[model samples]
Target: MFWRLLSTICSLTSCLNAVRVPGYDYFDDSYYYELKNLLEAPESLHGARGDHPREVNGWGPGLELGQVSGVSVDLEGRPVIFHRGPNVWNFKSFNATHHYQGEDGPIAEDPVLILNPDNGKVVRSWGGGRFLLPHGITVDHHGNTWLTDVALHQVFKFPAEAKAPDLTLGEAKVPGSDDTHLCKPTSVAVAKDGDFFVADGYCNSRILRFAPDGKLKEKFGHFGGEWSDSGLYVPHGVALDEARDTLCVADRENRRVVCIRAGLHHHTFGTPVRTLHPASRARVFDVAIHNGVLVGVSGTAEEGNAGGFTADLSSGEMLGEWGPLQGFRNPHAIAISGDGSALYVAEIGPNRIWKFTVGKTFLPTKM
Candidate 1:
């Protein structure tokens, strides 16, 4: 009742705190949106499945990282993974309040693992008792690690060599749509300038942008309607292409990967600039961008189309499709090397990590 009265008495700008983004005078107009060739996705998309990417066998041996939620590479080109350790997210994991119903509290094993890229040896492992139901991760250009937890409904930032998170957003165990709260925030993408974007996928169905100091800057997105230009359903992953000023989102439930403007200006802030669809049945899970490539991985066991595709990040042209030579059970998260030579994918059901050499030479399947 108090909020309702205040909203009625105040203008829209006065009701909520606003942070102005400085750009050219041309970009300052909120009434005009400049959408180029962007279009809404069709009801059902069909395309040819490209080639198979030979998966390297015996990559990360003896590493018991369970249900790898996200993967990224650090400055030294080492693979870093955020996982659930021993905890599994099941149907009964969360109650009606989106709170953990488990009696185990938090998993005992370390949730973050840094590995040697060449032989896949666990070099550094930490982040124990710091998260619940880990969901997403991004290792930035500055070597800062970003992570998200659906159970806690929060996002955290662990500085390059820091033991604890120097920055964290969202209330622990609390969920709300206001600027102070995030509900089931799945992924985060940090730009070179320290600005970042978060996909509040589950509860709010919105994409939020924040400044380095953790202030809400701008946001746009909606829920429902499969073809809605700004609609987001289960956005599981986000990737920022620093060079092209493009930010691609793995719109999981929608079965497509969409790109939007990531810099000082946007055509339509929420509208997709280019939409790339995989095999119609595949549910896009995670995406990685590098060079001129955009790789999207999907895992839909029920659809029987669990695989991935490589596309032109700028033109949305289908370049290739990838999967394990032994087939993927339930691939979850994907990460690309800084040089765009190596691709890493993690699976949940079989609890496996795969390393794919982008172009060719690799150790063949050992019989």
Candidate 2:
């Protein structure tokens, strides 16, 4: 009788613990509750078949890294994504047991670029010697690739065919320091006349402008939390609005996207025309403006953090969010297609890239 009573009490405790809590159901499913089922028994579902398991699509493999930091669609209509890993040399360094032994050992360093939603082919790969920690990538109209390495404190411009960069700017000229020159540059944007802008993000909070000949034309912004024309707090991403002649800056820590109107007086950053502060407290990371809409990726505060959201560009309304999709594990950067038909996200922790077919309303739909 005592054993029977104890078993009943244990069952009741389990039931109580499983009770649904409001706003705590991070993963909500409509049909079959597949995500819930997977959460309950992850090992059993590892190789099982389903409509869409988290990682692959139709035999296309995903990326391999600690986290993916940036993504862009190439001129050939291919999706290229970049990853940031903790260890630069051996994959074993990623394991906690071996992490300390290799603190300074030939740290495995290389940023991976994959052509996804297209059979997982690595069409081109570069930047092991170029970057200590690669964070962002953008292609100019001339078909050249521009990449930012926060650790190396430099921005490299690699021509289409060159294995190494044809032009190296910023910290490449001076080693081992974060100055106004290019301290941890995160994002890059090219103008029509061949000039470019680099968001010297992360440590030194300023935007550095360079002319076509690679000369420092001017620099603006400072490090601050205020919302005035004075400073920027961890500016991570940047974009150029060619038609509006404006510069869109993703002031990440401040939780806002600030617009610098073109033809305005120099060093003047106008008020944000659109703000994307959700009540959930997620912070904005990388942003891209396409088709008159602003698309961005929001990240949680913790490491190995999964589950991000999207918002409307014009109204800042909650569009839709997915994941905790295959244990997302820290989605860092985002890119949208020209027509807004697809949204590509880079999962930095799991070292994978996910391409979601945006629904008619610009949200992810179950495949």
Candidate 3:
């Protein structure tokens, strides 16, 4: 009610310097949320460089994993992921009317994978049963792979040695919010003329855009309206910096990482051309921008932390973190390697994929 009494009057106090109103500064009026004064990450770039080119070793086949949400890096740079073979995203997976509460089938195994970035193995695997809960994975710039099935709330597009999906986009099992449905479509970003960007995740926290022949061209966020900082709650990942056209999102419940000015030559959305909170208070699920670096990743352990951080998406700073004291627990998804020197991380309870390197190396600068 009234945003739960303004989140209990912003947790009983400094509601971000006495709650200033007007077009309101998101986060201060998202009701209140700051967490030990954000922005830290330095100690010469905290815990980074911890290696593991690939851990779980046991590539595909007899299935059995269930969480490594998503990771991407293809077109000869290998890596691709998207786990949950033994399926597990409880409360009966997909609800809120976005279909699938059970038995919409598929999850028999091959929830796509393709490691081997120097010995992670699994040379290549195909999406068996063709997905249901597998979260996100994009490999554009020509090797097309795209996926994003929070239990089939749709979004797919596979092509190089295709297994089927010519380009799918919502509706197969119906989720909603106009222009053909897409409720939990967490993450997808492309555009070197293929123009994609979907992060229509978890309910209706928007941000769409399509047209790589999939239609639905525009629809920026909304769904939190209360958790502002330019709203969007479970927007769990989306990236595209095609040289400053920007779009980066991973606004996972406001832990932040939001860039704006969407692609196709930017239309300048009212606000959020930058917003990065970093320093890992956890929850910022996925994001990756290579070269000028933006790589984020956080996970459920939250206040108890989880791994990843690295900023400077055009001066939003924060520049580095390695979370939960470096054991890096849940780190959902992150991909960076278009010569930004490796760094593929996808970890959702043992469904591993690590591979770090990146000490410094940018010369692809756009900012």
Model 1 local distance difference test score? 0.75
Give the Cα-based TM-score of candidate 1 against the true structure. 0.81
In the order shown, what is each candidate's alpha-carbon RMSD? 21.9, 10.4, 20.2
Tens digit of lDDT per residue, candidate 2, span 1-367?
A: 3345445655666465668423323324432244344444333222111222233333236445555668877666667766656644345332332112234322255564647455766676656544455678887777778887655567888887677887787654232223335666789988767788888876667777777778876666788874665478988888776665567677888866666654333434443455555334456677776644555666563634334445444455655444433455456777766555666777555566776654444422221
Candidate order, TM-score descending: 1, 2, 3
Task: Select the stronger candidate by lDDT from 2 and 3.
Answer: 3
Report, for every candidate in turn, its global Cα lDDT versus the true structure: 0.75, 0.60, 0.71
Q: Tens digits of per-residue lDDT for model 1 on 83-201?
A: 89778899988888777676666767788889999888899988887787998888988999999999889999999989889889999988888889999898899988899999896
Measured with C-alpha atoms, the lDDT of residue 29 in candidate 2 is: 40
Off by over 4 Å in 3: 1-78, 82-111, 119-127, 130-151, 154-182, 187-203, 206-228, 232-286, 289-293, 296-341, 344-357, 361-367
Better by TM-score, candidate 3 or 2: 2
Q: Where does candidate 2 have its weakest 10-residue lDDT segment?
A: 44-53
Q: Candidate 1, residue 129: CA error in Å?
A: 1.5
Predicted structure 3: clash tally: 1
> If both were scored by TM-score, which would come out higher, candidate 1 or candidate 3?
1
Ordered by lDDT, highest first, the candidates read 1, 3, 2
- On TM-score, the candidate that comes out on top is 1
